[model samples]
Target: MESPFWDMMGMLGIYAPLALGAIGSILGCSAGGQAACGAMLDVESGYGRLVGLSALPSSQTIYGIVVMLSLNRTIEIESAPGLFAIGSLCGVALLFSGWFQGKCCASAIHATKSKPEIFGLSAAPAAIVEGFAVFAFIFALILAGSLPAATGGV
Candidate 1:
């Protein structure tokens, strides 16, 4: 392959974590937002609460952005594969967590809309999903630190 292509690959490895995470966040937010909208339609009150609930899934994207910033540095061919492995794994983990969190949030929104008393309790599942995301973020940071600093060359 051309040298530039290889360079791009290396760059992709470093960027994948943030990109995938953002994708997951987008999906998660969409799911929750849709559910929130539906819930609001069913209830005359608590429109503000439902809208606030929809934002729960957006935190994953912010986490991803933080990871991306921390992982930022020159890309070297020698370390590219390692970066790719770590970033992609982290990205996948975050993605699933974020997506499921959204699903859980949607369920919570639905359940709480019916029983306002259970609103806090209903968020447990989503909180669990967020915990998993935090785990992924922490581990990714730890793993990323182990990778060699880029030599900034092919």
Candidate 2:
């Protein structure tokens, strides 16, 4: 029988990816949105760009969803360890990536607001953070693929 701790871990693993991703998205979006609101108060011509930049942090949530889908499986005693390790690690990676990306987006918004010309350069940080999120997503998929299919057979 699975220990109570393993069972709890398995339960958390099932949801960690999606939950962490959503938390990060919420935090990141709020940060970027605040920056966008401030920038809108200061600028009039590039609202579109500002809004786009502010949304850069949302990618993490999508990545999280993908990981969650890939990690989905029946939580059995033998499957619990892999699920907990992979799901939680991926979740943490995506969570931090989104939050940092949002900070980058906020920075980009402010810089673009002041200069109006360095828009592309300003977005580079967020793009780099996105790269890290992508890395986590890819690795999680790769690892998840290696796990044996949970076949509760006789």
**Candidate 1 residues 97-154, lDDT tens each?**
8788888889999999989999889989888889999998888888777888755522
* TM-score per model over all chains: 0.90, 0.93
Q: Tell me the spans in candidate 1 whose CA falls farther than 4 Å from its real position.
A: 1-6, 152-154
lDDT by residue (tens digit), candidate 2, 37-133: 9999999788988888888888888888888888777767887888899999888988898888888899899999999889999899899889988
Cα-lDDT of candidate 1: 0.80
Among these predictions, the greatest TM-score belongs to 2
Every candidate's lDDT: 0.80, 0.85
Which 10 consecutive positions of candidate 2 have the poorest summed lDDT? 145-154
Q: Cα lDDT for residue 17, model 2?
A: 81
Among these predicted structures, which one has the highest lDDT? 2
Clashes of each: 0, 0
